[model samples]
Target: MSPRSPREISVLVPPDLAPLYPDDPSRIGPYLVLGRLGQGATGTVYAAVDTASDSPGDRLVVVKVLTSPELDSADAYPALEQRLRALSNTDPTRVVVPLTFDSDANPPWVSMPYLAGERLSHYVTRRGGLGTGKLIALATGLAEGLSALHTRGVAHGSLRPSEVLLESHGPHIMECAVAASAERMRGAGATWLSPERFRGGTATPAADVFAWGAVVAFAGTGRVPFGPGEPEEIAERAAEGSFDLDGLPKGLLPVVGRALDPDPERRPSLREVIGAVIAVWQAENAGEDGATGSPGRDELAHVLEREWQAVEPPARVPQVIRLEGRMSNHRPGRALFLAGSVVVALTLVGGGVWGLARAFGPEEDGALAAADTAGERSSSESPSPEDDPLTMVVRFDPAEQESPATGPWLYTPVEPEGELVRGQGVPTHAEWAERWEAAGEPGLAVIDPEAEVLCAKFCAAPQHLFIDEEGRGTWELTGGDFVDYLSWGPVVIVEVTFAEEAREGDDTPREIVRVTELFTD
Candidate 1:
């Protein structure tokens, strides 16, 4: 099946979308637009300044301004806004945090806590699998985040890797859809299956699981879950339960197989898949006897390391190359997937998935794997350190703490309070610090609500090379390509930690791989 043209999937208006806002940019109620972050199919996100308190400018927020005024006021989308608001109130951690909901504006907008990080696409392309430990951390945290949404009777509907944000805080899911019922829903909310959704079908948790599998596929191989084609074609193949899994790691075969099941009912739940993946992760890291026999874990780890280094940062001198790409080229409501390939190409290079397409694309599916490598090589370059901040490293510390009521806590230096013991890495302490420092002193910070206590749940920390006060450019690594579900931006990282007493109980440590570096110049 041929890929659909851009005009087939969605339409894009001119960049001058801000004029629709009738109110002053600084005082939308109590929220202020510090800078324009990015726009999505449904809304525009701006880095907003919360002027509700004394330290008005100090409080940062992501204000999601709806692009269409009619959609906001119409009764057709009744439960849409209400559903998101409910999600925020019931499960604060389920989706991103929504601070305020206001329909007073021409196009209603919501103010949410600003996420500091890059898009997951950017991070994954720049950095390959973050080792077994990091992968476990990310997957587990995201699972909990998913669980939070599910518990609230909300299905992410869209659970693609690009939609998942890997923030300094942790991995987070975004783009909740109650409004999608108006059109159609199908096959787990993955964009590649949009056409199939229009046929009165609804996206279920199982579909979400399948898309999660695709996310894992991209994370592991840096390729699409299925062969590259239009949304209809991909859906057709997915419905047939046919996928190219030759490039997937043998350890992940079982999980991928179950996730891609043609029958949604046959697919595992997100919780179950998370358990299975976590088990695989544990086994993979079990050392000598415990490591899976499929491939040399050390060799794979090294390959991933090289891939991470290949994502050259943009040039030190910032020069905006205006690409005359058309968002409107893809048809609105149609499956324009050539763009998916392009998205894959761009994100893989950006995430540092070196030779990923080459490793997994063609030899596995008879597609042009070389094409992806060539594309990545041609366009990949280190982002400019000047004008924009270069995100060096992102670390999630479940142990980090912050004062309460201060709102979103900021990044602080990691103390490394003997967090690691023997049998973890480098086999000793001396090597651990060396490795940590070499990795660029990555630490964790939180945005918890504690009156006087130090709560560590909502922490965001990034290794910043150059901090930009202008706030014009977003260092976006993950979640940059998708819309914000809970808050103004997508949830890049979602984390849940348990105390020692509860560790033996149902509560255990959870880590969501956060897409880091959204805020830069």
Candidate 2:
């Protein structure tokens, strides 16, 4: 059977798009730009509709159009456009639809099915990360898609999470176009790039295989393979292949571990990668392993539907924007997409004003809009960190109350243990200290709701980094291990003893409650 474009495919999902900025173009080529979809280093991706099409399948298509370089200079435009044309010419891979390009248009663009759902990056950031089933499903879909593309001699030079869209159906691998020459695409971020790319190798099928490992590793665990840092820092570590596939399950370890092999020759082909993924579930499920494997398209689709229920999209952009009289030639100012190597910024045309209805609500301050789209997402969806400060870290004192190794421990936010447990006569850290002094019986730190409690280590700006979960989160620090005592039941801390520690990039120590675990002092 032939592959169908996303627009030609059927499912239920209305376009979740933000309204165009005053500087954004009303129409690109023949399609009316209904709203902006997302921004990345390549350019602004818009959710647009073709008024001429009466069929629902043909009504909406996503447009990837270039804008001025507030985010990028004009010099790189040709190369980016090359990637666009590269994407447009490819035959549809499994579940990945074909693209349609309009080269004649200024700042040329390509159109594809309007995929509904959050970018993998956004979804991971918002909902922690994918579960085992969905992770397998995602990995399977991507491997299947890439394997098909490789058969056609195409290598998706860039395979970062941003390049993969998590739709209702499954993972859709975008921009699988290879450059006319064998040279690798320059902008694929260093974090996800294979070691060979850093060594000056082109974006070969092998490179894609390596990068695919990085993408899936990131999908299953929100942290990138290598710990977080600046591009230079990450590039240095990535080239050395020093990332931890830590949080991933044992069965799926080889899928990422082997594929991430620095030597391209040693890396498995996409086909082999798919087999490994299947082998994982097949081994566990035993007799039930079917032709399509355990978690296939249907499973992935169901996972998305369940997970996406609470994930309210940023308001919807109209499927059709009236252009009869309101159409204008005002090209959108410049758009920036800094995704991966480059974080994406939206198109912004300054000094122009429009009183149009915005799908994303009121206009953000120009300065704020320049930040990553995650800001837009947070504003539209969840409360800011300022509103809910739940970032924390684990510290193991390993010392008893009597000896109570004298240290900066007292300074940390000890659960004000005026009472025990939750209102169970937990005493304040100070009170506990006083009591420990009296009876030598140490107490837990109870949160003094009256005073502000600060995070000790693993604390940083944009509290989003320290997710409210276990497994020492990606705090951008290069040191420290989580205090692991699994017997603590499902809870990591029923709370803690008070102690002081340093947060990221700060010499000033802050207060944090510590868990009572036996550490060999």
Candidate 3:
């Protein structure tokens, strides 16, 4: 937090391209240059407008140009481009909304959601230390966002304060700005980065947490966590250093310290870190006017209970239908696992008496099991509850009918209202469920808790990706199972589920339910 002047550096485009950009602004595709926002060692960013989408009502976007062809030509560019493009469309809760990527575009550009807010660095610079409430909100939101990216097999290589943007809702990390790559690490200032990263190691959740600790320190006292100096010096110190948080606020010190741990493996998981920070905030700030900390655990729990009770849960609805029993000799087994692409085929095959048409009901006790038993002609009923029928009825239209249906739906009723929660490297069923709850309560299709829980609405779109919630890669689903996937900065993967009921409120919702189960390999 050095009291340096807020410098707005302008980038002068090459002369030959002057006609494309009337005012010396770089031109790429259908975007109009406004002014230079900032610049890094390998790239320059501009606050530009999408001429294609700028017809009165269209929104603005910030375009980042990787000026150094050397890095772009290296192996890093392709992977970075693919990752960024994936994040933008798939992740709804992503702070950094990638609009498009054109490596062939004159400057090799990447367009993202033009966030109109102060950088986390600038925000702290202008307004000293953030209050506890705001800090808690910011940290919680960020941790969740990072968790989402990690779940998608991506790690934000860079997590500095400046890389984070503070928006009206919360913090939005800018993944492209850093333009992290293996070449960038090996070529130029690799020595200035963290020790674990410099040793040919990629980014991880633990490292992000460590950077987050530095961000907390910066927010508390305008200074880099590893002690401010030249960029290289700071990076070098961080690679082999630790932070001393003894003087910081009692509740926040632990978060700052744990995140700043030198060893990536030793640091707290994002879930653990968030839990600690949230607990501290709740304990100290609950009900106290202008207080940064929350109330005690019991009090906060009571408050949460009261709040939950106040908002009546949405009535259950039928979205998708499934069968539980094994399909006999005639067609597919009684319990059929249809490939996402084979919906119509399965419907055609399961018609007539063999088809068990079970209606969807709410999340009541025996409703699911009862629905599974609608059409079978078995007497002894050999299997118990665990081994009983497995048909799940998901009701998409809960509002259409009030009285409980005789059968159950395939999807579960998830509460999807709140800020988005990021997944860890791989998310568990619970983490996926939590993210669903945060994303305006979107519906979820737990395909195989033993395999991949078909999580919908991790961001704005419905994404379907397999995570080794069980830790063994044996259950991973490759490529096609998901409808769409979006990356938010470098911290989250927005799993796109195409079912009609997977709609979300305005902003992209992050669904961070199970972090321990995230798989990267």
Residue 499 accuracy (lDDT) in model 1:
18
Q: Could you tell me which 10 consecutive residues in candidate 2 have the lowest summed lDDT?
A: 357-366
Superposed model 3: Cα runs more than 4 Å off? 1-27, 51-57, 68-70, 90-94, 177-193, 198-200, 229-241, 287-521
1-521 in candidate 3: lDDT tens per residue?
A: 55523222122221111011112343334454543444334455554444344242243455666665345455655676666665664453635756777654445667776544445544564456766666666677677777777776567766666566664455666653233644465432332245676665666666667667767776766544665344556566766665444445679887667667667777889889879987876686556654455556555434333322221212211111122233222212112211111111011111111000010000000010111112232212222213422221122322222111211112333333465444445453335444443323333332211222222222111122323332211222212111111101112323223222324463332222111112221
Q: How many angstroms is residue 166 displaced in model 3 relative to the true structure, after the best TM-score fit?
A: 1.6
Stretches of candidate 1 above 4 Å error? Answer: 1-24, 54-58, 68-73, 90-94, 103-105, 127-130, 177-198, 287-521
lDDT of each: 0.41, 0.47, 0.43
TM-score of 2: 0.54
Model 2 misplaced stretches (Cα beyond 4 Å): 1-16, 56-58, 67-99, 175-188, 287-320, 326-521
Worst lDDT run of 10 residues, candidate 1, spans 360-369
TM-score of 1: 0.49
Q: What is the TM-score of each candidate against the true structure?
A: 0.49, 0.54, 0.47
* Model 3 lDDT on a 0 to 1 scale: 0.43
Residue-wise lDDT of candidate 1 within 232-298, one digit each (tens)? Answer: 6766777777777665667778877887787677777877876686667657666664455444545
**lDDT: the better of candidates 1 and 3:** 3
